[model samples]
Target: MDTVITVTGEQSANDLGVTLPHEHLIIDASIWVPDGPELTAIQRRKLEESVSMENLWWLAAYGRQPKWNSLDNRRLDDVETAKREAMRFVAEGGETLVDVTPMSPGLGRDPGALKRIANHTGLNVVAGTGHYVRHAHPPRIDDQSASEIADEMVGDIVDGIDGTGVRAGVIGEIGATNGFSDHPNEKTVFRAAAIAQQRTGAPITIHPPVHYKEGHDVLDVLEEAGANLTNVILGHLDGAMELDNASAYYDSLAERGVSLEFDTFGRIGYIASEDVCFPLDETRIRELRRLFDKGYGDQLLVSHDICKKNQLTKYAGHGYDYILRDIVPRLRRREFSETEITSLLVDNPARALTIEE
Candidate 1:
């Protein structure tokens, strides 16, 4: 509650410069990989070939396929590659990035890796605790009680991760699946996350389902568990534009006092619903302005939810610097004053991520 826990060491929230509140420097997720011993060459080629333009569109509109999963593209294992990307973000006026890589196995369970990135690139980093989505968690999570899960999450925040003595500053990127359904495992984790938040005072960032109803359902679970709604950040709202009643939906959330994280700036291609017909950035900006118009400016945050290799510069995706390089200027041109921009980029992050304990 007193200081923001950075990978380097504890520091004042005032020192956390323009921050990307909901992003990941290294997210090695094997969530969607089809289980197999090994693929034959033809099978491997077929799997690789399955990732076509149409396939991505299908993924955006429909759901995951048995043959077509983003397995190979889900890893950011090269620390040097991540370091190069972090420096790019820092150089372009970004000071800190809260990496929501959780303690889930096969993902970002190693706090040492985050510490290494911060120590090398001199970028302030904050790691996360708890499991991610249901599919991302290990099988053991299903058998654990809520208190048990919360204890482990607290350990990740207070003790360390992977026995490296590097603590997590946040409790999530805790996840809910389509429609934010109260899947037993997801509900259990949500309850555990709320208890962890109440105990540790670290902010909770939720990876919400894209459906409009799912957002509110997630809040319901968090609130029922007595989590402080102010510190509860509902992420992935940029893609929520696919909803027809996006305005009213976001308004309701903002009024409930949760932070609205428009964390996917240049990530329009990664749609999940069939309704995204507008230009990506334009739709995002419009939706953002609606939130502001509804008097939710102070509770807003933005970032690039970069989780794939193609999302890096070398792989033809917009690098980590894209938000600063392209989006900020566009906001200025769209008549958002410097003061308004500062509130979203600077002030909101400091306040939202700061524990209320």
Candidate 2:
């Protein structure tokens, strides 16, 4: 099967050069709001009430539901803005932007959207397929068989989604929550992703449930699925980078010829703010040196997993700019050779996203 699907004349993965293995142009959790007629007042209130939580003082604590306009900046679906952002990143030396927007419940699927954005932005955009986790999957997925899910994913890759000619270049951000042992859905999702990888030959990237035990479980599933471990990437390892855990994860995956991705570089306060950590200062440099010493440097890929629209508000002050400006120079100051730094930013990612013609 042909892995590359052209949309709006942009080249596919095989043509994308110096790719950032993980990143997004536009993404919204609200995109998962099921499509239908507008919700009634009573129904809307009931839905809001269910997600509302109470604090110790009995104050209603609502989770930060993103202000759709605020989070997306009203330009996510706009081609002009996407073009500017992509051009800026490319001008700054980025070649490809891997959109890991997996197929999930409530999230509207638009495989052709990337093609439109890429055509406007002049950035090589690679879209993804495969279901997320149980929380993100439509309720009906709970009762579906593994083969059923796998077949659906294969359809997304082989058959163009929504009757659009665009097809997925990758198979994840497959969500694995907690340990794979206890969670049946995580295992199911993993199995489905593995099947997608085997069928498509596109690289698979896993969003492991946690940073440790569950992460190992994801690797186990990928191995069993016959995914070319060399082409797989274990993402979100930065959350574990503070300790020797990053080394352990990288070394384990490296031994299997897989890549290790540390993409949450600039997203300091979002997502796992309390639990998520960055290896900046001497700590980051030391870790890089340690990985290089262990012969694992070639497998490391770095980026800022900026998913929110607010993240891209400023050109040079946001997104990958944070890493290219702040982090890269700091690593150099700490005696990380320019050659090594280039390999991490340019070479390693290029290899990870590269697919044979």
Candidate 3:
């Protein structure tokens, strides 16, 4: 039987109930933080303070401004806080959470911490193995060949991550930006992921660029590198649905047999901080219906992708239970059957994450 590897150990796929396929329990994503002279003294001080009710609105409005907001929101390193946030999902009947924090410098990927969280919460924590985008890549990456990188990833899957004895079950959210041509180091990591996937039978999930068209470029590199398209996932697709031909674009991506992960479930409204305006839940429901109507329900995955401090319940955001507490009921109202919801939350993740025997 195929088994799903967890930080604790191997688990039967049937037992992986009501899974959230993408999440981060412990992470430090400060690589995205910008240090520039554009900030005034007060703005810089505000940036240092933790996110709270008083400054939450300002942070949401200008968090990505680099010069205007706080950098504390870009980090999630407290294990106790992570444990508390994870339990919120557990209370809502969620079982498995795939923490896709890649093994890149400054982006905390801790298998020991993951194992501890699993032990405490009784949640199946599946860790990932891969490099992130260009900025997160280590300085030694220049000296390593693609095969050498793949070897490290393979070791993480087959043996353990950094001698922690906690094997990774998945191979991403390996990151890519712009297009395939623009970032050679990202491409190298992609190729390494493809190699590691073939060797270990682990699934690959990619963080593609914002442009929906550029997703195809990422697929091209993975496809050419001999990765299994069926086990590949393209994440953050919700952020790329603004163009006129988005529906058709999604259809084309579905046709390629890769799982399209719409992981930003609860992040609604305009994120002026980043100049990004995510579609409302109503719009996302329509898109799901569109994909379902086109016979691509099986090629879909969903999650909250809660990576920032403002996204947690402690900061008054929706927290990890948003999908179960809010979105699932909306799907029912929209006429999505129980079987369809099961396929999305249970069956798809089980199939995508199981390591072939």
Highest lDDT: give the candidate number.
3
Q: Model 3, 160-217: lDDT tens per residue?
A: 9999899999999999876557888899999999999889899998988854458888
Give candidate 2's root-mean-square deviation (CA, Å): 6.6
Q: Provide the lDDT at 316 for model 2.
A: 26
Give per-residue CA lDDT, model 1, range 171-230, as digits (tens).
899988885564889998999999999999999999887444478888888899999999
lDDT of 3: 0.87
Which 10 residues in a row give candidate 1 its minimum summed lDDT?
A: 270-279
lDDT over C-alpha atoms for residue 148 of model 1: 96
Candidate 2, residue 346: the lDDT equals 68
Candidate maximizing TM-score: 3
Steric clash count of candidate 1: 0
Give Cα-based local distance difference scores for all models. Answer: 0.79, 0.64, 0.87
